[model samples]
Target chain A: MTQVIVTVMPKQGVLDPQGQAVAGALGQLGFDGVGEVRIGKRIELSIAGDDPAGQARAMCEQLLANALIEDYTVEVGA
Target chain B: MSTTVAVLRFPGTLDHDSAVRAVEGLGATAVEAWHADAALPAGTDAVLLPGGFSYGDHLRCGAIASRAPIMGAVRRHAEAGGRVVGICNGFQVLCEAGLLPGALRRNSTLSFVCRQMELEVADDETPWTPGLETGAVISIPIKNNEGAWYGDAGTARVVLRYRDNLLGSTDAVAGVANAAGNVMGLMPHPEEACDALLGSTDGQIVLAGLIA
Candidate 1:
């Protein structure tokens, strides 16, 4: 069994309000040098297959991430 | 023959009833189509994807519902130049389904906005806005958590513009149509505003376009 992990993030230049709010909170807490914060989601799937990474990529392309506003990376292991 | 409009009902759709009511009020027959169904009702002249948190808004606002079984038929319908209108969450689904241009993202303010807003009819040539005049202002209510629209529409027509840039949409776009002009998606609840009792009858001016 291979574990595929997909990380999806708001594409650069897209407005990520939730990430900005978190960065604002960090700034208020005196965490200096926080340049930019963009939030995203991670999806993990357990697959029993020879090409789990390829399957995960196909899933990302089809439904897991929207190409219009988001970019995703898939990694396989374990 | 009276036009028949198919109002798609996804599992979590909240505004299907209002859409049906608005369609019936426009003197059109309203048929309810299910998300899991593989086809729309026969003789459907138009398709309406009403607002709601479909699939519990999982993955993204409309990500899951966009691939619902009935969407294949909707896509075919749009390809044949059938009129399709998506309101609020429906707009998100349209964008996700690639039937419309641009993507609706989380509101820039990161808040669920629910308010009556004025929209300027930027273009009145699409099937969804034939009853409106270019530059006319209409009152519609917008309610959603992820209603901010992103991306350049390129050749698609910008049919509606927010009068006050309420949700940080690019160029204050409230509604838009595909390049072919048969499909439209907007971030307002026109169905909810279809009656004078609901504080506005202006929505009828929009929905009435579906009947023909």
Candidate 2:
């Protein structure tokens, strides 16, 4: 079985209200030097395939992420 | 002939009844369609994606629901020129489904806004707003946490605009129509305002726009 991790984050130009709210809370807690924060989702998948990267890409494009507003990266586990 | 509007019910959908009643009240037939079903009800003239947290809003609001098997039918339907309207959460689904442009980011206020809002008619020729004159302002209920409409709206026409930019949407767009004018997605709940009990029948004008 091949394990892969997919990370989906909003595109640079998209507004991320939730991330902004979290960043605000971090500032209130006195976290210094935090410049920008963007929110995103991560999905881990285990599949039986020789090309886990291909499967991961399909998942992200078809269901795991909205390409219109999000960018995704996939990592394969050894 | 009476038109039949398919009211889709996803697992987390909570407002299908209002959509049904709104269509029936206008003398059209309302058929219940399921998200798991790969096909729409036979002879469905239009489809209404109602409000609710589909799939418990996992990943993102409307993200999962947009991939439902039934959306295939919806895409085919829209491609063939069938009318479709997504309201509130439904609007999010349409955007996620790629039937419309943009994403509905969390509201700038970070609160679930639930109240009556005034929408100015930006386009008067779409499937869901033809009954109203351009620049006509109508009252309807706006409710949702991720209600801020984002995206360029592409070549699709803007059908409605919030009078005050309540959710900080780009261009203050409250609703948009496909370039073909058959599919629409809006943040406001026009179905919820179709009766006097909801404090306005002005919404009937919007729904009737589909059938008329």
Candidate 3:
């Protein structure tokens, strides 16, 4: 079984209210030197395949992430 | 022959009945369609996807519902020039389905907004807004947590604009039509504003374009 991790982040220039809220809260909590903070999601998948990373990319294109508003990265683990 | 409008009902849809009634009140025959069904009813002239938390909004609002089997028919119908309108959550589904341009993001306020808002008829060329004159302003209720429309409308026609930009949508866009002008996705609840008792008959003006 191959394990894959997919990380999806809001595309640059897109408004991310949730991420902004988190950044604001961090500032309130006394965190310093934090530049623009953006938030995203991660998904882990276990599949029985030799090309799990390719499969994960296909999944991101089809359903895991919206290309218009998000960018995704895939990582494979043995 | 009276126009036949199909109102689609996905699990968790909250406004299918209201959409159906509004369509019927506008002199169109409204039929209920199911999400799992692969085809719309025979002789359907237009389609309406109503609002709600379909599939409990899992994996993102409208992401799962946009892939429902019935969407195949909806896409074919729209491609063939049939009128299609997606309201509120329905709008999100249309965006996700790639039938419409752009995506809806969380409102800038990070809170759900529910109230009547004013919209200007930005373009009267689409099949969904012919009843109103371009530049005309109408009041409709908008209720959603993720109602801020983003991305460039591109070649799509901007059909409506928010008078106040309450949701921080790009260009204050309230509604938009596909390049072909047959498919539309709007954030407001036009179905809920179809009667005076509902505080506005302005919605009827927008919906009447489906049959007119």
Could you tell me which residue pairs clash in candidate 1?
A: none
What level of docking quality does candidate 2 show? medium
Worst 10 residues of 3 chain A by lDDT: A47-56
Positional deviation of residue B12's Cα in model 3 after best superposition, in angstroms: 1.4
Give the fraction of reference interface contacts each candidate recovers.
1.00, 0.86, 0.93
Q: What does candidate 3 score on TM?
A: 0.97
C-alpha lDDT of residue A66 in model 1? 91
Give the better candidate number (1 or 2) by lDDT: 1
Residues A1-78 of candidate 3: C-alpha lDDT, one tens digit per residue: 898999999999888889899989999999977779898999999977778999999999999999988999999987
TM-score of chain A of 1: 0.95
User: How high is the lDDT of residue B69 in model 1?
Assistant: 96
| Top-scoring candidate (DockQ) | 1
TM-score of chain A of each: 0.95, 0.94, 0.94
Candidate 1's C-alpha runs over 4 A off are: none
RMSD in Å for all candidates: 1.1, 1.5, 1.2
In model 1, the Cα lDDT at residue B104 comes to 93
> Of 1 and 2, which scores higher on DockQ?
1
Cα lDDT of model 3 by residue, B1-212, tens digit: 99999999999999998998999998899999999999999989999999999999888899999999999999999999888999999999999999999888899999999999999999877777665789989999999999999878656589999999989999999998889888889999999999899999888877876784
Model 3 chain B poorest ten-residue lDDT run? B124-133
